[model samples]
Target: SQTIHQWPATLVQPVGSPLSLECTVEGTSNPNLYWYRQAAGRGLQLLFYSVGIGQISSEVPQNLSASRPQDRQFILSSKKLLLSDSGFYLCAWGGDTEAFFGQGTRLTVV
Candidate 1:
């Protein structure tokens, strides 16, 4: 069985601060990893994705960056967070057809 975990389910940060969020998967190897953000009433936007370790593709360029340091670990980081960076961040992994999402991390910037 495969499962994903994320920390600090909710966070409130001041604008212009740094941000780091981590996600890890268990019971899978070399699975495709993806980072997505969902805004209020908006569709999900892919931020980054990795096909393997040390291989990442950025779908959108903003105040965010992603890295894959291990086979099943993905990290999202921001050097200086902006007010617009606030949203629901999700980590997912799947194959050619389906993907599973984490509970998601809700970030609120003020």
Candidate 2:
């Protein structure tokens, strides 16, 4: 049974602060990993993705970055946060056509 875990479930941060969010998977190997952001009343937007360890692709350029160091571990980071960076961040894993998501992290940038 494959499962994804992300945390902290919620966060509140001030502008210009550094950020780090982590996600890990179990029961799968070399699975595709993705980072997505969903703004209020908006749809999910892909932020980054990785096919394997040390292989990452950015879907958007902003105050966000992603990394895959282990086969099942993905991390999202930022040097400085922005007000627009506040949103629901989700980590997902899958391949081909379908993906499964984490519970998501709600970040509030003040």
Candidate 3:
């Protein structure tokens, strides 16, 4: 079965703290992976994406970075957190036609 798993489903961190969020996809290889942020009443914003290992594309400039350490593992990290960074972070993986999303992590930076 193919599935995507994201962890620490919810988080509360003080400003200037560090953050690391992870996601892994199973049952697939060389999949297109994505990291997105969703804020209340707003559409999803693509933060980073990877088409293959070591091939990351950033959609916007922000306080976050992403890395694919393995074929199926993706990580989002931040060295210093900010209150404005609080949001619902999502990880997804897919082929050209369909995509599957993880449960997501709700981050609150104070």
Candidate 4:
């Protein structure tokens, strides 16, 4: 069975601090991985995606970055946090048409 794990579930961080969010998929190989952000009551926005290890594509110009360290692991990071960066972050993995999402992480910047 394939499963995705994304962490810290929820976070409260001070502004200007560094941030790291991790996601890892099990029982899958070379799956397409993506990082997304959903603002309160807004549609999902794709932040980054990777088709394979060391391959990443950014969908938006934001303070976040994504990386695929292993075939089934993805990480989202930021050098410095911003108030606008607070949102619900999701990690997903899928095949051509179907995707599986993690529980999601809610981050609040203060």
Candidate 5:
């Protein structure tokens, strides 16, 4: 079966602290992967995406970076946290027509 694993369902971090979130897909190869952030009561914002190993595309520019270290793994990282960074982060994998999402990570930066 195909599934996506995303970790640390919720987080609270002090401002200026570092952050890392991870997601991995199983039972699929070369799926397009994405990282999205949803602010309170707002639509989702695409942060990063990857189509293959070592190929990443950034949809928005801010305090975050993403990496595809392996075929099935994606990581989102930040050097410093900001209060505005707090949100619901989601990881998803897709083919051309459909996408599946992981249970999101809710982040709060204080």
Candidate 6:
């Protein structure tokens, strides 16, 4: 069975701190990967995505970046955090038309 694992169900970070969040999909290879952030009641916003290893695309210009270091793993990172960066981060995997999301990580920046 394919599953996505995202860590640190919740995180608290002071402003200007670095951040790294990882996600991996098991039982699947070369699946399309995505990173999304949801703020309060707003809809999920696509942050980044990958079609293959070493192939990453950013959906928005922000304080975050993503990388596909392996076929089934994706990482989101930031050199410095901003107060506006606080939100729920999610990792997902799927194909052209369907996507499966992991349990998101809620980030709080102070």
Q: Write down the lDDT that model 2 would get.
A: 0.95
Which residue pairs collide, candidate 4?
Answer: none
Candidate 6 lDDT for residue 23: 95
**How many residue pairs clash (N, CA or C atoms closer than 3 angstroms) in each of the candidate models, in the order given?**
0, 0, 0, 0, 0, 0
Candidate 5 lands at a TM-score of 0.97
lDDT of 6: 0.95
How much lDDT does candidate 3 score?
A: 0.94
Show model 6 residue runs off by greater than 4 Å: none
Query: Candidate 4, residues 1-110: lDDT per residue as tens digits?
Result: 99999998999999999999999999988999999999995899999999999999999898998889899999999999999999999999989998899999999999
Using TM-score as the yardstick, the better of models 1 and 4 is 4
Candidate 3's displacement at residue 8, Å, is 1.0
Clashes of 3: 0
Each model's lDDT comes to 0.93, 0.95, 0.94, 0.95, 0.96, 0.95
Candidate 1 ranges beyond 4 A from true positions: none
Candidate 4 residue 18 C-alpha distance from true site, Å: 0.5
Tell me which of candidates 1 and 3 scores higher on lDDT: 3
- Candidate 3's TM-score reads 0.97
Every model's TM-score: 0.96, 0.97, 0.97, 0.98, 0.97, 0.97
lDDT string for model 6 (21-108, tens) is 9999999888999999999957999999999999999989999999999999999999999999999999999987899999999999
C-alpha positional error of residue 98 in candidate 1 after TM-score superposition, expressed in Å: 0.7
